[model samples]
Target: MACVVALLAAGCSAHATEAGPEITAGPDGVSISIPVQVTVGGMPAGDQVRVWARTYDRRGQLWESSGEFVTDGVGRVDVSTAPSTGGTYTGVDPHGLFWSMRLPENEQAPYPLMDADDVVVLLGVDRAGTTVARTTLRRVVREPAGQVLPIAEAGLVGDLYLPPGAGMWPGVLLLGGAEGGRPDPAYAALLASQGYVVFGLAYFGVPGLPTTLARIPLEYGLSAARWLAERPEVSGDRIGVVGTAKGAEYGLVLASTEPSRFAAVVAHVPSDLVWPGLGGPAGTQTSSWTRGGADVPFLRSLPARGASSAAPNQAIRSADAYERAVATASRWRLAVARIPVEQITAPVLFTSGDADGMWPSTAQAQRALETITEAGNPYGSALLDFPGAGHLVGGVPDLPTTRTAIPYGPVTIESGGDPATTAAAVRNTFSATVELLRKAMPRGRG
Candidate 1:
């Protein structure tokens, strides 16, 4: 029951090696969002065992899980939950180290888990950390039971993944941030595996879409929502949106403006108020979005370059950007850019990283929480803030959490965050998001 996850160098004893272990996972195949039950059996009764797993991402970055747990009277352990005898967390925790593993950060290979079918090796050991048994699990890159259709009509360029069952499924509009190419299919596929019809939506940075994250019309998002609701395979009353970063800003606006169309929203690394266009230096600010040919008034963040002094807006790569953004709270709260949280009748789940270098996501989330409370929103709101985690907070948490100095368009932006904390944040947000969606959009499954 005293499970510890820190590095340890202990020896195994012969008495603790009576039988090897057998590991198994449920709901079929390695997937995300929905619960994947992992269980271990064939261990010595009334004893502890260490669980370990390793998987290499597409770019060859390694992700792992190492934790300790006690066996039941019949010699079994469920990795999805803490053992009754010992562990750092409790009560069906999906974010425990046993479930969501972490890998060391590699500056060279910052992206992980973007590819399909990454094989993961799971091992069970004794108290001394001696490898007693091992098995392999394939993280299914795509749901075999789902169908993906190309969506190019109505100026929307993306893929729509539908679960296999004939029953009307809850629909989710998934949006990525400014680093757009195609809406991430890996994330959308995983969500589809969990019985939801997910549309990997691309509003910009794709063929037939804008080349930059500038002056996007909010009606595009509204159209996507309406399209998702109209689909025969989707539950019209149970459609929602899942967005991160700039996409999160759009989601908040969409939920507020089209409250009746959405049942829930999950905004990962969200802002409390709309922000100005992402291109260019300070003073030459522009709107990031528009509606009906009019600009959606947005607040401005300090430019990363071209300022007389870099102290105010140069936090793009600063280690203390998270702290500084919160410190300057009074300045960013422009009444013109404030999103009407009260207007959103659907419940919202906001996830932020406290150490985010790109922007003040935590502070903005706090402002959102306050706004929701002040408005007395009947549907309510929730925030998941991770300390030491950086700007790369959303998407699937299974990806690498290394700092990437990649060129996002013409500018090179730093995606800051530590490996361990970012992994934890991903797990926390993913689980919470699924729960929020399920609660908000409850439809019968066939």
Candidate 2:
């Protein structure tokens, strides 16, 4: 919480004593939470001062947040405890969470600031939108230290990121969701920089692979892990898998099928039951994966609910629609679709958003925890539930808190969540995941 601000009057003749805000680091010492405090001297005592922050991602996309505060008797404002009545959202919680990494109301694309090198710009403006003062705060972690390379082997296509060092590192097999293409390398790069040999695995939708998610082979994931383990920079016996959304379902099934290959498992927005594979026709229900050439058991899709005529708001991904879909499915969806958590020998960590628009991830995570508890496994498992967040969790840090309408096959789906809460959940879960991996698969143990 070290102050990093310089005080200077912008357009006003006021003498301001500006001490920059404190950027608090989460447990992993990479992600950050801000508690801002601004003080101004010799200004109109009750005038309003607007506080805002701006930063850019590696791709040069801008991210920003702004809130207005009324000066106190001495002309000072505290963002850590102020009641936010305007800006991107309205709330009473202090800490400026409302403005941090939030997606603008009409914005179609929101790129988050990732990595420690990306600086956070802080600004103070008058009620007239004139700048009163400004400063910059550095992120917690240092620049990522890793080497990224493209790799295609045994039908797996993606990138590999190795931490900068000589000895073998613990390996992590990274998988993205049903987005059909190579997984984003940013996450793998970040984890590799933090100390791992991360292989961003793409099983389908790339060259030499199936174009859609229909009946893909689970063996591909297993082969990728085996290949990663065989690498000179990776520890074969100390390996883990990190998966999101659809990828999480694959991770659970894969870990269950090959228990000895993994020492740790991190599944975000996970499912306890097998789901029908996506990337098929809009409403078509079919097996998403297979093993030994046989289709895996999967839940059937219920009739989809049309968009509400009252609201006609396509931007809001209807949680009710997804909930109804799951509810109307046959009872077999629960019995036959259940993941075999009892077979997984590795320690497990599951994170979910309670307000996820895509599916009932929170409930599924709870069921998985219950099933694992019943199994009485000595390895143990844990779940992190985030309130007011959506299905998107765990990936590159500083991405938009919300996606308005991202394409989900033939339909453009919106992820529902409180932007601030979603951002915080992602960051905290990432740090927790790193800690879990280090403990379960400590360096040099393999």
Candidate 3:
């Protein structure tokens, strides 16, 4: 069988002669933030065909997935919409192969990490244990039209993503969770591709910054926002903040304290109450945030009751600890630790997963929404809750989600949620986030 492969800027397509099967995938290359269409043809009707996907992460570790499906009456299968009869994932999910990818049993990495801006996936089709057709898909986190610039001045460390051919654009201060050391630019670049000036800031865990989350000043975020607003390409009046986990807590505090600076806020797996910082010495209490050189009141974390230690590989469910902490906190502590959502002027968007293992994000998010409603804030707020998703609900959509537990120091951390539900949550959360930002901080505004 003669096979021809054609590559395009966005993705690749392949075709085989009547003697063999054919595979087709398009736009040639695509943003990792979106889904791709994949179809296989020329197989015998009702015959089993195995479709496989493989990609090398930034660390050169291979991640792969495969599914077996019976062709339709027309001898074709649309992988995008077809239900996998048996494989790494079941049901019909357009991006199932991507999210269900897994590393080889011998591989040591906890999960596939796309450290680079893009990755190339090799997709193959096989029949009767023989390969028939193959193609390649290029997934990118950053589009060619976007540019990334590192920021180190003004006592700040971050990367700024500039949209293509920009007039004044809405600005977004992007913040990450406890992993710290400058947020990854992948999501910011994707946002930049959508015409926003995104600054991925790092408050700690990097040089010239705090080595840990303890006592990080809230003013630091304000300073970063001010710097972002002052950018010539940024519309000062249309600036917003997007943060996840601990960063979400920080963003909420910033939005509440300096309501005039931010027009929109997107918090993912957020905490309604401030929590203590990490990386401090044992038995020491330190606030994760501060303002005007004073530590902010924060809910203290309690020790895990050995429940999480029962999991294999010493993977701990951090949510249990958080739940205990909240349940046992003094009334004064609860009152003081709760974020003053009423003080926020911008419309807020909170996304949480009910099954999040890192913390009780769903309950906290609901509490925040209730507070917003009670405060009668002129700018309204919204929440997007996913039933079974985990703390990894935020970020560029359509990436691998198979690894719900990841290594954290000597032990593993259970993030909760299965791959399919988490993938769905991530996509929906991303859509809602973009919608909120566009509506609250419309472009072309001076």
Clashing pairs in 3: 10-28, 10-29, 11-28, 11-29, 12-28
TM-score of each: 0.73, 0.82, 0.93
Clashing pairs for predicted structure model 2, backbone only = 5-20, 112-398, 277-288
Off by over 4 Å in 3: 1-19, 106-112, 307-312
Candidate number achieving the greatest lDDT relative to the actual structure: 3
What are the Cα lDDT values of the candidates?
0.71, 0.71, 0.85
Using TM-score as the measure, the top candidate is 3
Root-mean-square deviation of candidate 3: 5.1
- CA error at residue 260 for candidate 2, angstroms: 0.4
> Could you tell me how far off, in angstroms, the CA of residue 354 lies in candidate 1 after the best superposition?
1.8
lDDT of 1: 0.71
Per-residue lDDT of candidate 2, residues 1-446 (tens digit): 12223322242323433533222222233433323343433445676666666666665666677776676676655565556567654455443432355544654452223532434544445557777565565443333455777897666788888887678889999887877676655566667777898898887888888888878888988899888888888865658999988889999999999999988999999888777776677657778889989889887655335543323336445456546756777776667877898899989999999988877889888989889889896786899999998777776555556454555544556677777787778777888899889998788775
Tens digits of per-residue lDDT for model 3, 36-123: 8889998889889999999877678888998888899989999877899788988787888888898876565533266537768899
Candidate 1 per-residue C-alpha lDDT over 301-360 given as tens digits, one digit per residue, 9 for 90 to 100: 554443335333232363243344345656545777788877888889999988776777
Quote the RMSD, in angstroms, for model 2.
Answer: 6.2
Kindly indicate the candidate among 2 and 3 with the higher TM-score: 3
